[model samples]
Target: MESLVIPVLILLIVGAAVLLVARAVGRRTAGATGAAAKTSRGTPSGDPVETAKAAAAKLTEDQHRRLYALIAQGQAMAAIKLYYEASGEGLRASRDAVGALAAHPQPFRSAAPKVPEHDDDDAPERFPYRYRAIASKGDVTREVSSNMLNDEIYGRIRTLARSGDTEAAATALTRHSDISMKQAREFIALLDD
Candidate 1:
């Protein structure tokens, strides 16, 4: 009996030590898994809006439009798949990005700058392709086409017209197009909206 007591006590001590070690290991594993799960779930470390914007920047204009349309239609899985194919990212990454994009609606921002760095406001740049500006009022329709009149220039002309600067807008329109000042004024008058 005395010999059995010593062995039993040693056995109990070893079992307790083993239990403690196992618990320590389990805690460490649980902590690691918890952190990994958080990251895998697409938890953003920074501003969610900025994160969403960054994800949106990866997509092209068409992709952006389709993704948003899918999101708007409440087709999350389709949106994710579209993003996955369009972005060529891992499935997990695409899922996260799509989730972020869905949570925060973002406007499509073009990869290239809208305005040129050395753009001269005084001298309108001529584009390779001719841009056509059309205006309709009731039964009458007018059109102005010119290589120097892109969307930006037309937008400025419209802005000037809307801001009660019809003369300036007409002048700008004449400068950019082959239309006469009287014709430019007539075109500017139709751009009420």
Candidate 2:
């Protein structure tokens, strides 16, 4: 029994270390990109990891899960609203939270297109917005005017985005941005930017 004790202690220590590292990796990888991540950043000087972890910890389970889903779809406002609704504790607090959500809105990625990296220095020309779609269906074949990138549609898109319903937002934007893959990405850029 005494001889086995050392190995048992070693096993416990290894398990604890593995758990700690796993938690750290999970916190970072689980995060929503762009706006969701940025919104929780602790000032310019604060520790980003700490800030994000704190924010995630603060969220209730449902709001946290919804927030993760919504941020992916670029619906910052709706996510914020949902977060407030779920976590505000009571009626008056929740109502006040709604106003807070309206004022602050939700987060989104910036408007800049990610400039693709190159290996050889041939000086990459700025490629135009090429359409990118992993999948598409339904009546999204038609194109709409670009002017639909206005406030009203943006608000709708924000709501849709929070719900993780990009298709609906795309459909709405299609009423204004012409629904091609490039146009869809562009419309999202316009609204999110």
Candidate 3:
């Protein structure tokens, strides 16, 4: 038993060293290959949240307000059309953009950027509006609604979906909402469209 101690200690130190080296190599490789992977895989490079924020910035204050109003009213298709016409992006891209905006609400930023006056003086709770996402295939339909999901988080999920990482997207969806993996998959399937 005493003879076994030295070898076991050596093995533990070697294992820890190997793990540390592997993690360092993984970080280096991931940083070096991230852009290459995005380009090769046909996913847009750079931070998607910044990209989506830039896209949102293209909208004027009035257009931004109107878009949010449409989303708040739950007129998703109409909101998509509004964003399509406003952004001059393709239909599919517009759909994704609208979905992103809905999941993560952006306040209007203009030269002056006036805050829209609200009459609800009694309402104490502001921010974190619940957004609903609905997806259906064949006769099966699934809906996920959560206040925790925002445009930035949802944009990441959309990026995962666009990059053929449905499993990751589903995992993200499950993390953002109180849904099972199966339900998250169903919702993520709709996002790919």
Candidate 4:
């Protein structure tokens, strides 16, 4: 009975040590994972869209287009370089910004505040080349081609649509293209994303 007691006590001690070691390792691992998650999120709020928006706001329209083009072409290094140069930020910051931009696509938003007077304008400036804007919902697809519509104008229309100003977006679209109000509304509806 004495011999059995000694062995049982030793086994219990070893088991407790193993459990303690496992718990310590688990806590360390979980702490590391939490830190990594926070770093990867890149924002204190942990909202990827807001992070992307803030990063994108640092870029010009041309830079934004080129960066997204590079990303779309699967050229990560080029995108990072472009962002680094355009933003005048550190390489690490550029890399993180590019990652956030790629992960959550953001539309170009002008740094200047939008004027209500400009928004109320009924005429759209004519561009040298015809711009094509296409929108699709499910199986239905719509295309609007016009010399009066360019990237900037289309972007503004899309922004309006996304901001829940469907009437204004449709009005802008109708002014830019030959589409009627009803058709413009239908087209704007598909741009709600």
Candidate 2, poorest ten consecutive residues by summed lDDT? 37-46
| Candidates sorted by lDDT, best first | 4, 1, 3, 2
**Which consecutive 10 residues in model 4 have the weakest lDDT in total?**
37-46
Report the number of clashing residue pairs per model.
Answer: 0, 6, 2, 0
- Give the range where candidate 1 is weakest over 10 consecutive residues by summed lDDT: 37-46
lDDT of 2: 0.51
lDDT of model 1 at position 70: 96
Residue pairs of candidate 1 with colliding backbone atoms: none
TM-score of each: 0.42, 0.22, 0.34, 0.41
Candidate 4 ranges with C-alpha deviation above 4 Å: 44-51, 72-74, 86-96, 110-193
- Full ranking by TM-score: 1, 4, 3, 2
Best by lDDT: 4
RMSD of each predicted structure: 16.2, 22.7, 27.3, 16.2
lDDT of each: 0.85, 0.51, 0.76, 0.85
Q: Write the per-residue lDDT of candidate 2 for residues 1-193, one digit (tens) a residue.
A: 9999999999999999999999998787766333243332232112444334434545655666677677667776676667556554444333333344334443433345786774223332322343322222343342233443554545666677556776666666555444575566544543332
Clash pairs for candidate 4: none
lDDT of 1 by residue, 16-106 (tens): 9999999999999998776675433354524567667777888899999999999999999999999889877778777778888888989
Model 3 / residue 167 / CA error / Å = 76
Q: Which of the two candidates, 2 or 3, achieves a greater TM-score against the reference? A: 3
